[model samples]
Target: MSLPVPIDLHVRSYGRVRESDRHAYAQLVLPLDGAVALEIEGRERMLDPLQAAFIAPGATHSQYAEGLNRSFIVDVAPATLDPVVGDRLHERRFAPVGPEARKLVEFMRLLVERGAATPALVAGWAPLLLDTLALDAARPLSRLDALLARVEADPGAPWTAESMARCAGLSPSRLHALFREEHDTTPRAWLLQLRLARVCAWLGAAELPIAELALRAGFSDQSALTRAMRRSLGTTPAEFRRRRRT
Candidate 1:
């Protein structure tokens, strides 16, 4: 008998994250094409098609993707893995992708493609991938959470360095310093990224009209949303929806 699969699978086509959606799952994300940048732990790295990232569950992590970044995400829950693997992965720090890690991603892609197998059987085949990678990750767990939390809380809000710093109880200078140190990007840029993400999420989940989504996502008008959406995600709302349905 095989162990059950511990992941809830969802396929995302073209979208970015909203500032208010800073929720991270314990999982593996492998980009089949394009590139993804993430602030995992406290380090920022860009993942290409050849790379994979293992974000520990409940850890504050955020992702930014460029163009049409197609990927497969393996959502892992701690309860699904063995105690040894779970403990090790949970305690590990954030790190960059490695060659050995890429092999696991390739194996996973193959496993997923071969057939629809039981989660337990799949887990058994890749028992140690998480734990082994955990050993190599640099631990930066505490710094990114609060900022990410603020973003997740309100991606539509007009977030400025001064305003966000006040929200986080830090000075603008301190917030900028910390933001750069942790994510390799400015607070302003992160805010823009989050806004775009919200646009994507709203487009994906809600039935609201384009105008409402544009305003809710902080876009000034329909044209604004159209321009930004095309620049950031490379697709219009109608096109995205059509592709999503098919």
Candidate 2:
């Protein structure tokens, strides 16, 4: 018998599940904070905050969570999922959630917290989230894309052209060429733009001191953040925050 609403959402904290378990429904495991290591079919995969692991129904697996980790576990019945998404889940075990998936996860979290976990709501949104997971899996990512995801995950990292080239397994010149071809900008410029945008976003949302905000956003100091903001938006971080509040 098919379940009426085959969607289940769970929030888990740091722990270890050693018993090899398999279920009739596929599971999506998203690490919202810290990290999780899952052993599936005798192979171990580390899942960072930006990635999710999909466990095919009846696949033997166990998981361990590092300190203070928070994760979301979504169980989807094969019969309820779109065939394409179900097939994709069966094929790939891990996928990057990206921005779209993060937003959907946040929305789901809100719904669960608000006591709004109705069968109708699950029926309406589960398919969309699964479809997003499938699409992210289907898209082909370049070496640059992989590096960029790492950078985006930690924008405060000290990044240099040579260091980034090493990460991509490409020569510095080749990395430059690839960036120019893909983004029409040098790697440093692109990174700076990303940092500036992140700083601006943080300014609007956080009440951190200017120096802390600058440091968090990958700037050397408050003055460096000010210069970049002035160059890009012609406004200081203070002014940007003021405007956002107004």
Candidate 3:
């Protein structure tokens, strides 16, 4: 039988809860008003309003809250989270919750208050929330940071400044202006650089063929990948791979 999607959100006033054993699902604890002290994998940290702690599935951890601490406990199936997010969360125990995370937490609060958290809605929001949390944890301090993170996480995705703006909650014009001011380059150019970097990394690490590398690195085809490599790096994928091997 197929497993049910594990996604849940809880908002409550917390008290001192003792340490516990590992759980089967990953957990994220965000304090809205007060703080939570957490020990995950033998490392302890204080989780305040600006911070969140990610407990990996099957990780050993314990947590406690003093007095009346208002918090959000988000539980997600590791398999349900985005691959990059899941990997990153498993890599680290704590991260800062930026404006994007706050926004998501507020949305969850509203849904909980309205008694509108249907199963379908929870499932849909689970991935988005986790993605936002991961992005926030990466210190994406601005709209451009968010946009760049999205592109870097999925170089295979079809990206445009307009679509990126929508993702970053900004107008296309504004995104363009910020890119020019801060990066001195267009969004597409930055994306191309990310893609090329991905290609180069794979070329050095794996023995995959050029066509496979092209598809994996977000190029349309082998020819497209070759053209990009030639234009940007002054070498073809085959030549680059050969040099790396030698």
Q: Model 2 residue 1 lDDT?
A: 27
Clashing pairs in 3: none
* lDDT (Cα, tens digit) per residue for candidate 2, span 164-184: 999989999999999998778
The parts of candidate 1 lying over 4 Å away from their true place are 1-82, 88-141
- List candidate 3 segments past 4 Å from native: 1-5, 140-246
Number of the top TM-score candidate: 2
Task: Rank all candidate structures by their TM-score, best first, as comma-separated numbers.
Answer: 2, 3, 1
TM-score for each of the candidates: 0.48, 0.66, 0.53
Clashing residue pairs, candidate 2?
none
Residue 67 lDDT (model 2): 65
Report the candidate with higher TM-score, 2 versus 3. 2
Write the residue-wise lDDT of candidate 1 on 1-246 in tens digits: 121456643334435762212333466666655677766666566766434566666666677765776676667666665666556555543343443454454455444543444566565645555655564454333344545544544566776788888877788888888888866788887777767766665665667898888888777887887887788789887777566555
Better of 1 and 3 by TM-score: 3
Write model 3 residue lDDT over 92-144, tens digit each, in one string: 77877665565566566556544566778877876777787777667645556
Off by over 4 Å in 2: 1-13, 16-26, 31-34, 40-43, 49-51, 56-61, 67-80, 96-141
Q: Where does candidate 3 have its weakest 10-residue lDDT segment? A: 144-153
